[model samples]
Target: MSHFSIIIPSIRARLFDCRSSLFATFVLLSGLFAAGCSGSHDDEVGGTPPATVLQFRLQTLRPEIREIRESITGTGTIGAAQTSNIGVVTPGIVERVFVRVGDRVKKGQPLFQTRKNDYEISEQLARAELTAAEARAEQARLDYERAIDLLGKEFISQAQLDTAANSLKAAKAEAGVAEARLAQAAQRLADTTVRAPYDGVVTGRNADEGTYKSAQTFGADSSVLQLQEIKIVVAVVRVPEIYITRLSIGTPGDIFIGGMDGLFQAEIYAINDKVDMRSRTVEVRFGLANDDYRIKPGLFVQADIHPPERTAMLLEQDAILDRSGDPYVFLLEDGIAQARPVVLREYDPRKVEILSGLGEHESILVGPDLIRLTDGDLIPSIHDADR
Candidate 1:
């Protein structure tokens, strides 16, 4: 019934007749049986066809072309729009401190008052001198007028008229000098009261009652008081020079302060042209309105600058997949799934834009079924009938 069964008996029959009969017959029969069995098995298994092709059922959508808005972020510090150091314009001893740190002040509001006893005395003396000078000048004026009339009448000599004219001129000069001195003394007396230059909040106070201040103590490094305008604040951010060209004044932005519940609206108010040599960055400032006084100076903040909207090819967020750390997606090509690597330009929570490796009318697979699909696999799209 089998080739091996028939061959073994025939080899036994010829074993004695052959030269080296046992060895030759055994070898010939072994080779013939091995060849016959392999042929039969190959036809049994290899002739069967491949299993059924796998099909993945999925929902699909076409690539969308739409406008997308993007944002560039930078870290910065919140600072006042304007700051001033309130100092004594005249050297004096502090008499009273009307305001302290955290006090809100208006323009021309008195912040502190210096001792005015000495200045008042000087002012009174100057006024008294002015009064005396004016009396002398008035007398000289009357005498000169009378002398002129007398000379016209030939009643006074020319020498007498000349002397009267000289006296009047001298007296007027002295009166003018006295008047200037009085004005100077009054201004110095007024300077004893230091007022705010603008509406702001006092951030610091270096002097108190009975403290003496001099001109040498007033400087950027030293100040009697520090005041800053907090109604409107600025966020100073350093942006790399590479992105400077894309920014412009008045470009809208948002400032997010640390630990704040909501962000403040802002706009680009200043952009420095000079690049920092060490950091290669340019300083950019965003102005934010803080009418409620929620924002304060020296707070850390982040600025999100919205440049401009751009047109790009977009797809639903579910269609994207990661393969070996690179992003790609399964596209339905001719009813079959084709895996392609795409250049992702930008993305939000809902959608992503593909810069390349896709085209118009190309559909991508969506839903949780994406992980099951493979290259060249048939994807019988469930949404196809709806189309």
Candidate 2:
């Protein structure tokens, strides 16, 4: 009975251990089978997905070719059309000053007169000497004629006649010298008075009545008076060298003076041949009529120079992109973004003049979101409205 019980228990324990092992194995296999079924169902529902393509609805614009007249602007100062420093040619004391500061005078008008006492005395002396020389010349001529008659009558020798003729020649030379001296003295006397060179207004007065002025001190700084013709004023401005080719004499423009109302219509009167190396600009002058003496010299002015009109391609400023100091734009071709370099002639706040590198029919992308785009980007659709 003991052996039977032991063998039966051993058999039952072995069977229980086998059943436990099989149940655990079945549970693991069932879990793996469920995972496989789930994976197969997923494969049947959806396979490998397609890559997403980026699409942008971008606005585009075509380059415009039209007649454009660009206005170049610069700031400068107003100057007199003609300026002169009035000074005395001869040295003397200022006896009388006919004009004062801010006095308007005409051409050939006397502005001042120097002391005439010394010059007058010299002139009188020169005239008296001329009279004496003429009398002596007449006497020598009479003597020569008398000597010639005596020689013909055998009363005087040929050598004596020759001596008389020589004396007459010397006397005539003395008279000529006296006449030149008189003329020179008269000129010196006239130079003592200063006259107006042209029609102008006296802007300054450096000398007063009874003030002694010297001829050697006649210059801009030592001028007795400063005269300027303000009936017509000149507006001087500097223009960039790039636009110099389009400018020429008689080009029309406008100028605005500081503290003055309205624009002054003017024309290009002059342009410098050489460009300034430091500023890369050229000096230009415009002439404007100032009939009422409203425009004064040394006043600040702004100039607007209109260049000649020409046919050119212009694009909106939004379309241009700068890459490493070079300007380029994204061109739309066959629904693809293509980058193309461009050469610019001028730049403005709203538009830019294109010199080259763009075709007439080519379209460019322009909008606020242009920075997000790159070269070779696929454009799925273009905006309906064309700019």
Candidate 3:
């Protein structure tokens, strides 16, 4: 029985060893065949890899920058309008000047007076001529009456009577001329004093107590009082010719003087028809009331001309999402969002310009306060977020 047991055990061991070897040979051949099938044969298309999917957003945009025109600033001086230079109209030695520079004078106010010496002499001469002419005229009248009576009675020849009548008529005419001369001399003497032609401030005085002058005082070319009306001043402002379309007569504006901080409102009283060739600007007149006269003449001023009307793009304040102090937004494209930077041209409390960011028709992500977002991040945009 022991021998039979040993034989059975040897038989079992040999059969198990034979099965293990066959399994090992089968696994080795299978591995070799699989490697041979997968190996690269250097074919032209052998290196091709599988297609990949990259998640990204596609945003359409047409951005722009603000068009500015700061290059058009201009500088000019304010001045008084054109006026006549006042001068004395009658001739005499300057006796006394009533007004000096910095004095305000009204229309027809006395300014200066000429010496009465020349006027007195003229009056005396006229009076003497009048007396002589009157005496001669009286004598001629009596002589003519006697001649006429003699002729009527046929006691005098026609030629003698005619000559006597002619002499008398000439004497009367001379007397009339003397009377006119006397009146003119008197009027001249009275008008030797100069007066203001209109209400204005005295800008200059060229006369003294002893200065001799003629009726064409200081000649027609010379000036006596350089006066100007300053009740309302006209600021001569030079606006760039490029703004020609916006500028017109009667446009309202505000002027700021360099030395003062007060605002002076005015209207465009006048505008130049021609542009300055060298300065590339057009001179416009702005009329402002100088009631208190705080804004004096020759003050350098800067003025802002408001545009009557304008049209511009606007967006709601919340629509602009600021990132790192710069206003921006995450624009949606193909179910994803792309962060975009925008420039701010102008914005009030209500709206702002998307100067360089979102396009007209692009979809922008409104909210999700805690959403971590980046360029090409998947986003869900609902038209009505507040709903």
Candidate 4:
């Protein structure tokens, strides 16, 4: 027996109420499916099984312009963006140690001490000399007055009287010189003690108590206490030299350091004008406000530097179809894979930015099989549900 009807076919007939009455459901779903798949009765004229039929639809997925935060990570050691090596300009034996390693010190805070015996002795000797000079000057002034009185009566030679006045002036000048030397000696005594130049941590110590120090630099490692300022920290990032025009001094950026999960605001403090010949990358330095002193110098860091201004269409990477050196995508125009060529501006593994060859409000295929498709391929998709 043969049975044929518009309402039922063999594929629909075998499905009964016991089997979830899927035939009724299939019939209903088929109405929505067939209207988009094919519109002719001759589509079912052949004894083709539903499973045997191949329905390849070219779906156009128009993804939005995804805002991308691009970055170039680098590994660099921490350093005091502005290291102030606390040391002494004068030489002396260290008499006392005021601060220890890891101590937070303020600007001008005394760091260490030196022997003051020499300066004190010099000051005492200068005071005694000044006193002696003053007494001698007073005596000479009295003698000159008596000589002038006698010379008025022509009792002594004029040359003798001139000599007495000269001696008095000499004594007074000597006393003034002695007083200046005393003040200078006191300042030298103060300079023997080292002090912090800025607020920072004490990281190094080159001298110990009773150790001799000199005015001249001992070596490149002449610093006594190596202090690092963590309060406005620096983050370095190496970006491709090609992006030189995109980044310059004062550019805004973001910092993401390990253990510091949240995004921290930063600004481009320095952009190296010279490009590295070997790596062809430019170094950019960022300044961050690390109030808690968490962003220490020499800690590894990363940065995300956004472009000042760039415009492009972003789409999924799967949407790109590379065919014989010609990369293109099939866009849906009235529901079809209309293969159109696109200029790939940026082809990231996750997404792509189109410079041109696409229009707004046009649906484009983002399926994996975009490479295997061609122009004018039929798309039995009334807004492909899978897309």
Candidate 5:
């Protein structure tokens, strides 16, 4: 009842009666047998099943719009904006010291005093001379008045009147000279007490009770007290020539103090136009408010100079993957995941700015749980019901 049964008789008739055609008939019968066996095997096996498609239930989010900020980083030292090395104004021995190192003082507060003996004696002598000159002037004025009265009555000659007038003028001139000498002496006495020029902390002290200090003898290197105003500090950083164009006066930045936990806000207040040939860098000064005096001078600091902000596409950091050293993201398209390359402009721990190769509305798979995904793999979003 199979095709094999019908074909067997025909094959045998050809093999005996047609000797010339026997080879041809054998060839046909062999091919027929092979085809029949193949058909029978396939019928027993039945129909084939479809290939499997890999699937994952993953989460996704749309790219976000945000402002991308770029920053230039450098390291430098913190210092007082206002610094000075105080010196005595008058020549004398140090008599007293009111402040020591690390003492806070106000402007005009006396830091030290010099010997007052010579200056005080000079002042007293000048005052005495002024008094004597004043008395002589008064006597000369009385004599001139008496002579003028007598001249009006012709009791004194014109020569006598002229002489009295000359004496009064000379006495007045002497009194004026004495007054100037007294002023000079008084100033010298006051100069013995060297006061602070501004509110600041004393960083150094060179004079004690017996230290000899003189204003005229002091040279450029001489200093009695090193005072620095620390209420507002300056962070001086050297930025390379490349970043000079991006910075300007009033540009804001963040200063991270060495060995400190938090960052302090600072603003660019000055920029050096001359560049150092060896380092090829320009110096920039930033002012930081430190009213509490928590930030001290000579402390190391790291500065982050922020440039102007620009708009860009931002995405969650988890959505990005590094494949073969290139950044990529998997976007769900038509029930399948498609791998896409993107250019990253900036990044932080939570998010990244995509400079190019991504759209604002496109959804991307998020989280490391989907890292094993391959291109063209099926991803059925858990939120498909809402879609």
Candidate 6:
């Protein structure tokens, strides 16, 4: 029934038929049976096995050309448009404080007053001296005029006329000195009352009633109040030097202040010309309007500067791979994976702008299988994951 069974019976018959050459016949029959058995085994197993083919199911994407708006981000602090430390110009004991901390003030508004008795006495004395000097000058002028007339009429000696003229000149000089002293005294008296230099809100109050403020001393102890103008605010931010070239005055931006409800619209009002060598960053200032005095100084803030839009080749972030510090991607070429290094213009969590080493409509491998893939590995097919 089977080749091995049929072959064994034939071999036995051959061995018996040749008894004289029994040894030789048996040896030859045994070799023939082994060959037949080997052929049967090969037939049962379906001959030599076919070569193994490796297959893989992977996701791939093509780089796309699209319009993208680039945003440069930075963090900074909010500052008042203007700040001032209100202090006295003259030394005196503070008698009354008209405004307290957190009080809103207008231009020329009274903030505090110092003891004015000493300054008032000096001003009164200067005024009295000025009046007396003016009276003396007027009398000297009359006498000089009479002397001139008498000299012309030959009623007085020329020497006496010259003396009267010298007296008039001396009196005039004294009057001028007194006038200057009176003005100085008036200014000193006015300095006893401190007024707001501009419209602002009081942020600090260092002096209270009965506190002695000195002109010689400086800083908080000498200041009566600290005022800040919050009608407008400035955001001082440090931007990386790489992005500084893309920014200029009047460039629009959005600012996010900590604890604020919404983003504030702003613009690049100032940009520092010098870059910090140590940090390689440039200082930029954005202006924002705080008409209701809601924004305060020293608050933390974030800025998003919107640059002009441009067309670029963009790809999903997953398509790019980081080998050491350099970025790479696996490109599909003729059913094989090829590793390509790419230069990135910019990148976010979702996508990346390909500055070089990639072209639009080029197929690239993506997804988790990328880790297992190697350069020159055969890819049987590509799955368009982007679709």
lDDT values for all models: 0.84, 0.89, 0.70, 0.73, 0.85, 0.88
lDDT of 2 at 354: 87
Off by over 4 Å in 5: 1-68, 218-221, 309-387
- The estimated TM-scores of all candidates read 0.63, 0.76, 0.54, 0.58, 0.62, 0.69
Question: For residue 359, what is the lDDT in candidate 5?
Answer: 87
**Top model number, lDDT:** 2
Cα lDDT of model 5 by residue, 1-387, tens digit? 999999999999877778857778899999999999998899779865544665565777888787767788888899997888777888778888899899999999999888999999999999999999999999999999999999999998999999999999999999999999999999999989989998899988766688887676654356688899999999999888867878899988898998779988878999998998999888999988888888899999889999898676888777788833789999878877899999884467788878789988777886545788999887664552114
Question: What RMSD, rounded to one decimal, does every model reach?
Answer: 10.4, 6.5, 11.7, 19.7, 12.4, 10.0
Per-residue alpha-carbon lDDT of model 3 for 121-146, expressed as tens digits? 99889989999999999999999899
lDDT of 1 by residue, 1-387 (tens): 988998998897676567577778889999999989998899797887655666655788888888767777888798998998878877888888889899999999999888899999999999999999999999999999999999999999999999999999999999999999999999999999999998999998877788888866756545678999999988998776756867899878888898788887778889987889998888899887788777889999888889888677988777888823688998877877899998874467787778788886777787667889878887664684126
RMSD of 3: 11.7
Query: How much is 307 displaced in model 4, in angstroms?
Result: 2.5
Cα lDDT tens digits, model 2, 199-313, are 9899988888888888898578777889999999889999889888889998888899999999998889899898999999999999888888888899999998888887889
In the predicted model 2, the residue pairs found to clash are none
Model 1 segments beyond 4 Å from truth? 1-69, 310-387
Instruction: Name the lDDT value of residue 180 in candidate 4.
Output: 87
| Candidate scoring better on TM-score of 4 and 5 | 5
Model 6 scores what on Cα lDDT? 0.88
Better of 1 and 5 by lDDT: 5
Query: What's the true lDDT of residue 152 in model 4?
Result: 95
Off by over 4 Å in 2: 1-60, 332-338, 345-349, 366-369, 372-387
Candidate 4 pairs with clashing backbones: 60-364, 61-364, 78-297, 78-298
Instruction: At residue 307, give the lDDT of candidate 6.
Output: 81
Candidate 4, position 325, lDDT: 72
For residues 104-218, write the lDDT of model 6, one tens digit per residue: 8999999999999999999999999999999999999999999999999999999999999999999999999999999999999999998999899999988789998889888
